[model samples]
Target: MSALLVAVLLVPALGAAVIALFPRGRDHAARVTGTIFAAVTLIPIAVLPFARDDGWTTYSATPTALRPWTEFDVSWVPALRLDFHLGVDGVSYPLVALTGLLTVLCCAYTIGKVPSGGQGRTLVALLLVLEAGILGTFLALDLILFFLFFEVVLLPMYAVIIGWGGDDRRRAARKFVLYTLFGSVLLLLGVITVAVNAGTGDLAQLTGGTGLSRSTQLAAFALFAVAFAVKAPLWPLHTWLPDAHTQAPTVGSVILAGVLLKMGTYGLIRIGVGVAPLGAEWAAPLLGILAVAAILAGSLICLRQTELKRLIAYSSVGHMGFVLLGIATLTATGLQAALLGNVAHGLITGLLFFLAGAIKDRAHTGELADLGGLRESAPRLAGLLGFAAIASLGLPGLAGFWGEAFAVVAAVERGGGLWLTLAVLAAIGGALTAAYFLRLLRKVTHGPTGSASVPAGIGGAEWFAWSPLAALTLAVGLAPTLVLAATSAPVRALTEALR
Candidate 1:
């Protein structure tokens, strides 16, 4: 099983090497090969839950520690006490699978259509590199290892944005790298603090604030809060995101909105709260306040945006804000909701970016003033856009509903002056979410046909790229237990420290 985990981690990087080394002008073959490699990573992810250590189920229903279903660990640097450790438990598995699925889809999408500035093969290789980094971040059980994987994503993504994005791509890419580098510096500091003070970087030993004094935990969490907050782009730190997402290529936007932001939220869950429980409890109120602020701020900003892609980019702030809110509650229910919101946002928002990009491509302009009556011209595209928008606003029986709704429920459950107020504000934010999306629908799909002429037909490649995201949004929404099932025990164990 450990070997299987190692192979899964290596496969995408291998795909990248193969694609990069492919013969000149073999872009088509290189893309196909990259997609195949990406698909290969998914098989092991699906099989992992069955490989759980004995009593994964029995442990909590029977009382278990944080036991991963699959893990591979080995000594790396004896001096640093850092091991090359990786594992998949309920908390991280959903994200790993999300990363693999989106990467493969993006790779396949590339085979049919390459963005203008870059070669298809090159884009495919970058996607594979991005995938490997995201997967490694989710799986790494060593704090330093986690930071390394997290950094791996920065450069390739910047390359994608600048190499293939719009005319202003350079500026957006620069803002992205500089802001994240600022966060990375803090993340490195936090990781070093934990490793030096605890005498180990192994997360298996550090979870629940174990092996550290209260002062150390508090200090570490403060550093982590800022680092992950920047990554999360929480509220004020979020200025760089809209530009990056708006200027990025179609497939790049999908992956960016899909799973990249989850890295920060995941870090908050796995590192900030898990490794520093006391600080998490102490800081919960402040986190909740900022989360609500993001929700309201993002919603209001989105209501005023003129471009399609930019609106979708701002929506991520509100969506991710919900995920952060769930994490702030620090209850099992809240953590489970956080995980669900994380995955659902990937599915629903990925679809939204896809539809947004589709609209921009056909209309030749993303300006809202230029696009109208999409339903009359391209009903399928408009319909899909409507479905994705509704799901994103937390419509019932859609993938986006459970996470946002449960986040509010979890906040209310936390039951204090601060939390209760946050719940009310978050709910109002949800209403504003509906207002902006409906306003979007009114502008794009319901208004009289605009000057821009969009084709009535949808392409095979578009359908191929989009169907799974649409189907999964409905599937996960209706049966959220699919996401929540594996998460129960691990979330419970993490929350135990708070209790």
Candidate 2:
């Protein structure tokens, strides 16, 4: 099991090396080899859970909330007390799986279609590198190691955005890097505060806030929340996401919305709520307010957007708002909902970006007004687009429904003036989500064919890249326990810390 953990982290890096070091002109072969490497990663991920030598086990953890079914810990810097410690349990495994799945799909998509600004091989290499960073973050159990892994993703993603993105890619990439860098600074400070005060950098030791004082927990969680909020792009801090998503290439947008954003919500749950329970309780109301604000603001803004990709970007802000709202509730059900929301967003939004990118590529535009009557010329493409939009709008018995419905339920369960009000408003936000999506379907697929070209066919690569996500959306929706089954114990453990 430990060996499998090592494989998940290193395989993608090895894939990137294979692509980048390949002969300069062998672009097609490089892409093929890179994709095979990416595909190989899923094998370890799929097998690791089943191969757990023992049931979930805990180190000498406080409140006994930190458990890893498989773990690897070694001294990397004896002087700083930082170890090359990594682990996977119910809490992080689904996210790790999501990252692995999405990267392979994106790499596969790149094999057949390369956005103009960069060779497909280069983009594939970056994707592999990005996968390593995301995997490391999910797997890391040490604070400093987690931060290092977190920062590893920034540069490769910036390159992807600038090299392969749309017409204003430069400015969008700049904003993406700058905003996230600022967030990183605060994140570093938060991490250092926790480690120095706790006299250790291990997350497991600190999950119950044993060594930190109340005031320290308050200050540390503030820094941590804001840092992650920027990455989560929560509300006002979310300005970077739309521009980044709107200008990024299709695969770039897919990866960005799919798994990159999950890092923030995951951090908030694991580090913020885990390390500083009192602070989470202290700030739950304010966090809930901001989350609801993001929900309403994002949905209303989407209703006014004129571009397909940009509207989808803003919609992420709204979708993630529900995830944050769930975390703010700090209940087992709420946290579970957040986890479900994270994976669902990765699948549903990942597919939406793929479909949107296909539309843009065929028509050479994402402007809503220029993309009318898609169903007239391309019924299949339009049908896929419609399905994705419906899922995004949280149709019942779909992947999107459970997370959101449970989030509102959790909020109401919290039982306060503030929480009840939040519940009502969040339900309203759900209605608005439906409205904008229906409006999007009407404008893009229902009207008379616009002047822009609409391609009627989806190639094998697109289907190969898209089919799994579409199928999984319904699969997870129909059998949500596929996600929640592993999550029950870890979530209950974490929530117990809060109590």
Candidate 3:
């Protein structure tokens, strides 16, 4: 069990090193190496169901402790009481699995779908490194360990955008780094305050202690919430996402939307809510307000977007709005909504990015005006686009439905007049989501099938790349219990801590 946990962290890092060693001239070598690395790493994730889940065990360094899925901890910084600690319970496990799965898909997409740019090796290596960083962040049980892994992701992702991105790569990368660093400063301050006040940076220990004062919890939670909300790219702070998504390469966009955005919501659940229950309770109303604004604003904004990727980026704001809203409720159903939404959004939006990349690759432009009558010349591609679009719109039996439905349900059941009103607003946001997607489908996929302007259909590689996402969208929708059951126990435990 310990070895598996270590492998989960090490596999991608090792793969990144191997990819770096590939000769610069051999582009295919980097692709092959990345594919192998991601594929092999996924094997352990597949075995997660068979892995045992015992009662909680803590690997404590004098002050801090690490509690992982199957615990492992060792000393690193004695003076600071920080340790190299990692763990995952049912709550964190699905996300770790999702990260592993998406990394494989991104690697596959990168290997074939992306254009043969100059820095292919660097791109692949950065992706591998990015995967490792995200996995480590998900598994880290120690606050300092989690923070280190969380920040580690930013550099590799920045390299990916700048090295292989579209026209405004430099500007996009700079904006991304600047915003993230700003958030990081706040996050660091918050973590240190919690650590110093609680007398430990161990997540389990802090939650178990009646250590920090309520005012202190509120102050620290506020800093952590803002930093995470930036990552969630929650409403007003979401300015960077559209540009980043628009200019980024296909795989970059996929990973950004699919896995990276979830990091914010994950941290809010695990760190802010877990350690600072009273603060979470105090902030719930404000968080709900911001979440509603994001939902309405993001949905309405998408209605006007001509560029496909920008539209998807804005849609993410709407989706994440629901995620934050769920977190604000601080109920089992609310947390469940947040968790399931995280996974569902990952699949559906990842598919959208994959399709968007494919469209951009073939049609050479993502503007709606430039993309007409796709169903005619490229029926398969157009069909896939429609499929992804409906999924994004929260069609009843697709992955998208559960997140929106569960969020609204959780909000309605939460019984707060303000919370219920916000949830209802989110429900209207759902309709707006439907409107934009239907509009997208009507313009690009349903009109004038016989036009010569439409590009060709999906190729074999594209189908192979997209099928898993399409399938998972249906799988999770129909059998949400698979996700619900896995997440319920951990969410219950975390929410219990809040009371």
Using lDDT as the measure, the top candidate is: 2
What does the lDDT come to for candidate 3?
0.84
Q: Pick the candidate with the highest TM-score.
A: 2
Task: Compute each candidate's TM-score over C-alphas.
Answer: 0.98, 0.98, 0.95
Give the Å error, residue 87, model 1.
Answer: 0.4
lDDT of 2 by residue, 115-163 (tens): 9997889999999999999999999999999999999999999999999
Point out the higher-scoring one by TM-score: 1 or 2: 2
**Alpha-carbon local distance difference test for all models:** 0.90, 0.92, 0.84
Question: Residues 1-499, candidate 1, lDDT per residue (tens digit)?
Answer: 7776787789999989998889878889998999999999888877877776554433343221457787889999877777899888889989988998898889888877888997899999999999999999999999999999999999999999999999899999999999999999999999999889988888877888878888888899989998888887788799999999989999999998888988999999999998989889889999999999999999999999999999999999998899889999998888999999999999998999988888888889998877999989999889999999999999999999999999999999999898999999999999999999999999899988888988887777788889999999999999999999978878888888777
Winner on lDDT between 1 and 2 is 2
Ranking of predictions according to TM-score: 2, 1, 3
Report residue 432 deviation for candidate 3 (angstroms).
Answer: 0.5
Model 3 Cα displacement at 285 (Å)?
A: 0.4
RMSD of each: 1.4, 1.2, 2.8
What are the per-residue Cα lDDT tens digits for candidate 3 across 1-499? 7667788878889998888888868877788788889889988777655665474432233222224457567888999999887767667777888888878887777666555455666777788898888888888878999999999999988888887889998899999999999999999999999999988888767753358889888998999999998887898899999989998899899889988888889999888888787889999989989988999999999999988899999999999998988898888999999999999999999999999888877777888877878877788888888988988889998889987788888888888688779878999999999999998888788754422365575566667678998998999989998789777767766666676
